[model samples]
Target chain A: MAEGALTAELILGTTEDVLRRYGPAKATVVDVARALGVSHGSVYRHFPTKAALREAVARRWLERWHEGLADVAHTDAPAEQRLRDWLSTLFEIKRQKVREDPELFDTFATLMRENLAVVDDHVTGLENDLAKIIADGIESGDFAPRDSKVAARAVFDATNRFHDPIYAADWKAPTIDVAFSAVVSLVVSGLSVPD
Target chain B: MAEGALTAELILGTTEDVLRRYGPAKATVVDVARALGVSHGSVYRHFPTKAALREAVARRWLERWHEGLADVAHTDAPAEQRLRDWLSTLFEIKRQKVREDPELFDTFATLMRENLAVVDDHVTGLENDLAKIIADGIESGDFAPRDSKVAARAVFDATNRFHDPIYAADWKAPTIDVAFSAVVSLVVSGLSVPD
Candidate 1:
């Protein structure tokens, strides 16, 4: 990486640490630069304002989420299996994030609310990933032809309970697995083509 | 009706009026009682605490939502058609609420956050209403037999975007009706028994 790119990467890392320590409201550009042992101007050169920095952190965090699900989408597994595993993996990733460091997860959730533009882009990115799998399924004759973009979103929204932060409280319940399975199976069966 | 029964009904109705006028935080039993020309103690006889009063109002608001869908559940239409109409009605009801008086809808959304117990009961109640239609489908052999309760919930969760408050911002989009139709058709197809 170029020298500037390295510094920008460093700024993003330190910003996460600063956010973890002081949270979004209290964390500042100065705090991030100080954590990096660099000048605030140096950080500003990379990210012009606190909002820009926060948006970058949020985008980075969400991109990491997509990273975890990408392999499931790319695997040689059948389309139905791949879609099921992709959703199950996504749900597990969100659940683990909440379980391991809920404070940080909660912080990011708050940041997500403010940075809807970032969230919107992240959502579209993941949905596009889903659309790719559906498009492949259509080509392989594993699924019926339909509007893949809209179909991908429908699949995501259908399984919202297993992954939506609002229902994170229910993730630990004994019945959640049952509910997840039902929705997954329903969607898969719904997508199957007649022989 | 007995005067006491009448009193509880009066308290509930007045509580809603006060909440709409003052929002959840500022509206109190005193305001509700004053609106009805009754003492706070009289209101307390029906609802012992502020939380209880708020719960009653929320329950009432949510029950009204169920009431709107109950007829669709009971209609002579086929199971698939009934489920489709039920979901469409719900989305319309939510859209109407959002468009007709967003302030009231937003107020209930906030109150819903604080009163998860009320929300839980309301969810279960609505899901049960859904389960009834699914059960009828199973009995009539129009649908496959499975766990009706769980299946009902999946159907409900799949179409959540049209009705969930978190996605309320998207409910007004021109494309929302298209999305709703897609998910509804998918779920209806998912629930169909193979010929």
Candidate 2:
């Protein structure tokens, strides 16, 4: 990575660490700067305000989430397995984020309503992509032609529901795979019709 | 109903109304007593403590919910139609509650983590009854046995997940019905195997 890109990643990592240890209310750019052994001016050079820093963290989280999705989307694997892999990755990311940095999780939930407008377009894009892939499967005789839109939404909603429970700072991966498999089986079999 | 039962029912209704108007933090026994035009002592006679009153309200909600499930479970109707009716009633109750008694919805959510103990047994009972009915259908060749426990839990969990957006005081029944139908269809098809 370039120098600036590397610094940004370092800043993001330190910011997440401070937030997890001290919570969003107490974690500031100064804290992140001090943690990084850098001056406040250096932190301010990259982030003008605390809110800006937090937003950057949020953006980084979103970007990483999408990257995980992209990994599954581009894989040369069966659609159903790809979908499960994607879900497992998504849940694991959420689980780890919560376990490692709970303050960010708290910040995310508190600000999700505010940030959803910015995030919705990307989320909608993902949902649409997944829907189209499922639809393709149905068309190719690999799956049944169900209401791909609704099926896609159910998968999206159910998988997201695991985030809150699985990411409790004292986290456990209990039932994550169980719930994921149940929903996946439901969707796959639900969509498959006999020839 | 007996006299004591009648009084309890009356108090439950008034308490729900008070919680609806004010939030959990503000809804107290005095407020409920005032709403019912009764002395605080009369309210106390029915519910000894504020916690007791809140528990009663939660219990009442679960009772009504299970009553709805019981209606469908005991019916001599087809398994498919019965499942559909049960899910529709579940979703519709959430829809109407979101609009009419948002306070009750709030109460349910506030107690969701804490007072869920009250509903645990009730939910277990409902799940058991549901599993038995589904198992009976499978034995009778009316439906396929595709993990009745998961299906029951899915129906239970999905109802909560899908209606959350609705219960957040959004009254979008059409979208909710679409999601609900998709989940139901998934369960139905997953369980259906060729003879």
Per-residue lDDT tens digits of candidate 2, residues B126-159? 6776676677677678776567887676556544
Q: Against the true structure, candidate 2 has what lDDT?
A: 0.67
Q: List the residue pairs that clash in candidate 2.
A: B20-B103
Here, model 2's chain A TM-score works out at 0.69
Output the number of the DockQ-best candidate.
1
lDDT of 1 by residue, A32-65 (tens): 8777776788888889999998999999988876
True contacts kept of each: 0.65, 0.42
- The C-alpha stretches of model 1 lying farther than 4 A from their native spots are A1-6, B1-6
Model 1, span B1-195: residue lDDT tens: 233554777888888889899988799888987888777887887789999888887888887865768888888988878888888888888888888888899888887887899888877877987899999888888777488988888887777788787788888888887778778877877887866
Sliding window of 10 residues with minimal summed lDDT for model 2 chain B: B162-171
